[model samples]
Target chain A: MTSKALENGRRSKRHIFHKAKVNRSHAGNAVVFTCILILGAFMALPFVYALGSAFKPLNELFLYPPRLLPQNPTLDNFIGLWTLMKSSWVPMSRYIFNTLLITAAGSAGQIILASMCAFPLAKHPFPGNKFIFRVIFLSLMFHASATAIPTYIIMAKLHMLDTYWALILPACASSFGLYLMKQFIEQINNAVLEAAEIDGANIWQTYIRIVMPMVKPAWLTLMVFSVQSLWNIGSSTYIYSEELKTFSYAVSQVVAGGVARTGTGMAISVIMMVVPITVYLITQSSVMQTMASSGVKE
Target chain B: MNTNIKLHSLQKRRLRDGITGFLFTLPFVVGFILFIFSPVVMYLAMSFSKLSLNDAGAMVFENVKWDNYINVLFEQPDFLKRLASSLGDFALRCPAILFFSLFIAIILNQRFHGRALVRAVFFLPVLVYSGAALMFSNDALSNDYFKLLSSDSDETVNLAQYVISVLGGTEDSPILDIVSTLMDKIYDITCSSGVQILIYLAGLQSISPQLYEASSVEGCTGWESFWKITLPMISPMILVNAVYTVIDVLGNPTNTIINTLYSLAMDSGNYGLSAAMGLIYFLIIFIILGAVFFVINRFVFYEENI
Candidate 1:
């Protein structure tokens, strides 16, 4: 049957399926392309606009009927932002260091811990596994802000308030990464694990050496997610000290300079946005691969 | 004697596996207990108490029987009103996001030029709009700028209104109202559906080409095959995206209910009242998710061997 379709020269070498309206007609293709182009423009608008606004001179920033791209671009905002950073009480590098520390620790801990927990839950059917999974699933429904007060109280009780742990520990405990890793782990072939077991590998050995390597895409995706969230950790309910504040918190402080510093504020926003987008760009393929198996099964 | 020895070894292995599994999950268990479980309990307690700060800025809870809940539910109608409106918005946004993402995903899955670039563009929001980035992007100045641009586009909106009227639909017609609401929220819908589109694209790629080949051989058109093959195969992702969309929309910082709760806690310093409101809001979300899961579970097609 496929041979007949192939003989008709309808199948494109690039695509998997034979073309029998499966690949759209030219008009349909044009429509789809147009739709994609339009939507893509809308999706990219905010970043582009922020970039343009950051480059706009102070006089052009508040122009009525705002242009999508700045008419007169300048590096005054970047210069101003640099000058402002130099004048800060806490060194600008300190804020960057704090953000890097938190992002690195939080992301590493989240991925390692989530992958560790997910392996057992996915492969081993131990007692309380289902209940624990359900609890974790239910926890995902609770927004972080909703639980902020209690988390603050708990942190205070632990004497971890105003410390980096306040940010990193809670981030490490997030359930979404675990859930995602588990879903991906479940897609692994059981026979491979069994083969590892037959080689006298214990559960930990199998998890570390075999399962972990097999689920690299999952961990990569998880890393992107964890880094995205951690990189954006601004003012936390728990952390109060100046030195402990993240880069985002610092940028927000610059933004809080009000109307006069609008250009500088936008420059900071653009810088803040670039890091995660770069991470996503690097791991785009792995993230997409992991997402292929991200569906929830009954 | 040999069989008995084999059984004994099997039992020993089972015990070892159980211990290993438990050990593996210990970090999460401890973290969950300390961070999630205890805080949830404390928050529940706080909801039923009057929360005040002492001289040292320590939270002191004075037990108050049902007062906070009563105050949230009855004395102030704002919470409930916001909750209802948020839910209404969720109902509209969730389906629109799902449909838009799926539509985009289908286009993205097709063989095309600049597909990688398009995919990256679609997934950009997953990074760009998350957490603090969103907070920065939605700052007062940017919002004002966006508002100015939107107001400048009022002529286009008026043209839309004229076209609708010419089509014999009043501005206030239910269908036209929905269309206009969706039109206004197109940017928001586009931003939020990035992850959903990724999920859908993933699901689309995972579907076997042989199914399409067989379907075409059996005289199925692309449209027919899509409904017969694509929709059912993608139903699981649909369910996942639906639940995610609901949670995302509801838990969004810009959500009115969330904002109301934040203000009640932060500005008004009504911690007990805010906790009560949060609990109520959580319950509503929980129920809605349960209903979504229940309804969608019935139609979700899970292939056993896929």
Candidate 2:
């Protein structure tokens, strides 16, 4: 028993020495980890504070050294939020439906449209193919702000202002989605296409059948990117129609005017902001994992 | 005769493929011309014309001169000051955002507990706060409202007066004063490019673990291995983030040029100056981005090189 105890003591000493050596070697990484955590908390302050304030007693909100966490919290803010700008501000349900419709439609349209655009760029060898791809690439980096005025004017001319078509038609041919799809398709093996050809499949058959299966990861990535535009405030802000308001527009409206009441305003914004993201988290949990993983190339 | 037949078949195949490609890109081409190309040309034309609300509140287009541009650029005080302030804000915010985000990306790439959850939280702000969350939170955090509570006077509650108590610290305060100066840059970084850190982290992980193993076998420590191994591997992603951040901020509607455009269309009826400002904004971004691409191409080491 005494011999065993001594042996255990020696083993533990060696383990401690090894761990200390490892920690000393990676002291820099630990420092970096701490900095990252702090910055993350700093960046997350508004959201965390919103979450905290959303649940806090209205009387406690203005307390200095603001409570990072709520004390004696309730859902009264949410109760108040649901009824905000109650008159003539479009029903909350309508706003949510509008947003959902736009997000679903826009994402579906982009995937289909971008895939069609990507097919030739990825597989077909045509003259000026490189030039066409370059044009798409250049436009992919173009910000909405740069050409928003033009887009607005065009939408007006089409009599699409304040209508569903305003959101749908202008953004259908997304250069970002096309460029991303082409990049994804290029990673698929030529062997897959060759196999499909051997099986007497046409070009479309190969693309839809063999090639697309390999690019499931790409599809999820595009879905996430499309949601950004679909839910974006910038485009909605410029599109300029009250009846055509999206989820983002609704959220902005809750805060924009006569919202001098801070906690309730924050509560409304948080719900509007979180509703879609929460839905995404639940439905696309697996896709989120794949999305992050695909961000890296092997 | 056999050579002629084969050449004819080849020509026909090329023609078929071209037609297919054109059909695929037809929507983008049509959308681009109708929405992007033609509208830009029209706006430039509109700037030279007289566009205003009539007594009946209908928009009337009358051909005017270069007066609009001259008035906004040379004569307007709010326009110039807002432009200068926005330029200052952009210059101040962009670098701090780039460094802090890339730095966090490196930290996240390390093997750690709760790494995925950490990434999700970091990315959450970017996805949500860029919209309504900011405007609402801005009201709460905007001003000093604490003073209003202590005073029992029957006046209206000055909410900003209450909140300003937290941030009313002097320029001489030790820790928080530094935070104050850096806070705007940090908030912008958090709001705009927090998701980018996740992208950069993925780029870092895609780096082969073998590189570190090989470096260590040759007696390289973590720091030296980083300089030799990490930066080169993630350079392409760095370019992606830089261009995205720059273009995103430059095109923000709250920006002076965009606000000017909105006001001109809605309030002022000075279409010509708005067009010039919009074009000038686009030109500046284009030139800066071109310069970035040139430098990045020269310095960045690609995996293909490896």
Candidate 3:
């Protein structure tokens, strides 16, 4: 009876400690929440300020101390931007069309090509596979900016300058995309591929039917990355034709028009960012999953 | 012998696999050689040759030599200083960005309400910081902030100055120096941190919760659990994020070195010098990355959990 009482006392002590732990966690929750909220606000600060300024009138664009929100919000800036574009020689719609065409085609091509190359590098045991993979990783070490002059020369030689090919072809064989996809594909179960092989599916058929579906999350993540990168076609310096000018290039031109065009510049900025943000929101969870699995092994 | 027959089939299978792999990678290989490799070779040659644009706007290489390299390395006055400052800037900002990202990732990994929304908010910057969006948003914030600070119309004292006065530190005190330098580039700090934060979050989430639970049962504090379990488990990712961040930061088009190269080639009509400068800068970056990989590889831990 004495031993039983002692056990009961210990159980009660443990229950009390658990209760305290729950209470302590509750207190911690409040602190953590506040910290996250502050960080979120900070992250959103510039975008918020720009969004506000986009709606503000021209006179209010550069107000000292910079009001967080416009006192008298208006859609005039967007209207003004529309008129400004309407007056341009190229017709702003054409710029948008060019951008969408180049970006869509380029990004799709990049994803497909990168995935194709990545499959062999990730799963196939071929001669020079390791050497090729190492070469691709090493390519990532250098800045693409440093290659601009030579790339310009290459495009010129291929007669691709002043054409959309200049923009699309160079971006299609992305080393980083290949590396990312390869790392992700390496994590898939070998058993699944072996099973497919036993089912009499050829290499191409397996890659198309089985491997693609299995790595849907990864490719979607790649799509998000590709779309963002392709959408941001700042001056291709190679593509100088007025007809080939991209929407981003047009916005940059207007934004460079100085203090008078600040409101319209902000409006253009908002328009440009909206698509990528939506894409990111939809794909981020999948991105997080793939990235966690894709962490490089030492 | 029976062994010879089995070896013959094995070699045939190997040949098939190798051929299939090559077929799969064909398009990428073709494009890679044409677009990347050829240009890289051309770039190296251009660095050692005088280049001029003909009336037809085609590039012509003449007088093949290392004069461009010599001129850039010794003749140019501002090249070395700019290189030093940019590298110094790169070195200082990387640790700050990594530390901040890791801190935010730790907090974000904890269970909380509206966690998805918070994560999205943090990630929004990454999505938005591209092309025209980046141009306007960053310019808007930093431009306005600078105007406000320099206006001197308000009664509010400078925050950094006030802190300095209170602390009574000399001009070169490490703390004061870092703070003052950091104050100027606050916009860059906030903008460049989004990707690193996502990376760290990925690393943190990959750690098994069971490890933490077991540590707690062993009478370990949260701090102790983090140091002993979380750090080692995520060391591989730390190295990945570090390499990624370094490359991303250096590759930014707005970088001073890149800007100088653009002006040299486009404005000053010095393509050869620009090419040489770019090559040298790239070499320096490669060396830096190699050193970083060497250092970090020693600490990276690969788990056999899978």
Candidate 4:
């Protein structure tokens, strides 16, 4: 009877501790809630600022005190862009077409080529495998900015400077995508691949069927990254023809067109930003997975 | 003799796998060499040579030893100063980026109302901060923003100055100077922290709840549990985020070296000096990465229990 009483007394003490913990957490929750609310507002401010400026008329854009919201909203900026394009040497639709084609081709090419390289590098124990991967990691350390002049020189020699291949091909050679894909592929169980091999599936069959399907999340993550980057490529120093220029390049030109083009510039930015934001909204969870697995663990 | 026969078959299988690997990596390797590696080697060679256009407008290079490197180091007015300023900004920004992202990630990890919407809002920067959109916004909006702030007679600008002064400072005051710098850079800081927050959130979620529960059972408070459990477990991610932040911060559009190099090569027609500047800047980056990799490798914790 005494032992049972002691157990009851301990249970009551634990319950009291739980009550204190819950009270403290309620206070902690308030503090956390305020911090997140302020931060979320700060984070959302730029999008709001951009959106507001996009809808503003030219006069409102220069208003004193610089209102975050437009005093007078209008679609004239977008209409102006369309009209401006109508007067230009190259048709606006062509610029749009060029951009869409390049983004689609570059991203799709990068994903496929990176995956192909990543699969074998991740799964196979072959001669020079470690050495090849090390070279890639080392290349990541070297900044590509400094190489622009020589790259231009080499492109001139190859006679590929003005071609669409100049833009697409160099981008496809990126090691970042390959690195990300390789990391994801390494996490796949070897037994799964072994089972396919035992069933008489060749290496190609295993990669296309088993590996590709298993790493779908990584595929989407890479897709988000590639599409976003390809969309942002502004001016290529190599591509001089107006017809061959990207939509982003055109948008930058519109921005540089002076004070009259201010509203148009804002509209173009909003249009450019909205697509990637939409994609991220859909694939947020998977992108987090990609980033988590990105770290090189010991 | 039997063991030798077994080893022979194993060797054959290894050679088969090796060929398969080579074939798979062939496309990327070829592209890498043609596009990435060749330019890098050409840049190195061009740095030591005088490059000029011929009568036919074709390029010709004549070897010119250490002249380019010496000129960049001693003669150029803007090269080293720009590099130092960029490095200083990098130092100031890295800690703030790490601290806020960690703080935001922890809060986001908590069960809160409309968490998904909040996450989408925060992640907006990662989407918008690249390409033409970012350039446009940075150029167009910042022009308007600066105009608003600098108009001395305006009420909002006046009120802002009043409040800033109340927080305490004249033009040369250090406390107010840091505050103003932070205020100016607030947008950039928020934008860059988005991906870092997501990475930290993933790290936070990967921590098993049972550990938290056990710590609570042992009478640890929330703050105490965070220090003892959350910090140690996510130490690896801290290293990753630090490296990622370093790359991203240095890779912004207005990077001084890139701007200076472009002007030197194209406008001023000084190819060799530009190439030399590029090589020195690259070496600085290499040294920085090596140091970070060494320091972080010592601290990053791996989960052994799994």
Q: Could you give me the TM-score of model 1 versus the true structure?
A: 0.84
Give the distance in Å from residue B55's predicted Cα in candidate 1 to where it truly belongs: 4.4
Interface RMSD of each: 5.1, 6.1, 5.2, 5.4
Model 1 stretches astray by more than 4 angstroms? A1-19, A22-26, A213-217, A287-298, B55-57, B131-182, B201-236, B301-306
TM-score of each: 0.84, 0.75, 0.81, 0.81
Question: What shift in Å separates residue B141 of candidate 1 from its native position after superposition?
Answer: 12
Name the 10 consecutive residues with the lowest summed lDDT in model 4 chain A.
A289-298
Docking class of 4: acceptable
Candidate RMSDs in Å, in order, are 6.0, 7.6, 6.0, 5.5
- Show how many residue pairs clash in every candidate, following the order shown: 0, 14, 0, 1
Superior by lDDT: candidate 2 or candidate 3: 3
Better of 1 and 2 by TM-score: 1
Residue-level lDDT tens digits of model 2 in B1-306: 999999998788668767886677667667666755566667667667666678998667777677666666678777767767877877766666677778877776566787666766777765654545444433322221221111112333332222234557433446555554455445555656664564565456445466677787765656677788888766666765666566666666546666666666657645667666565556667776677667775766654344
Q: What lDDT is reached at residue B3 by model 1?
A: 100
lDDT of 4 by residue, A1-298 (tens): 9999999998888789778988998998898888777767756665676788878887787664456678788998889877887887788788888888888898888888888898998887678888988787556655666677778777888899888988888888877668666755765657677778779787789889887766665666667777788777778888998889988888777777766777887787788887777776676655344323322222
Interface DockQ per candidate: 0.34, 0.25, 0.34, 0.38
Q: How much is the lDDT of residue A191 in candidate 2?
A: 58
Model 2: fnat (fraction of native contacts): 0.28
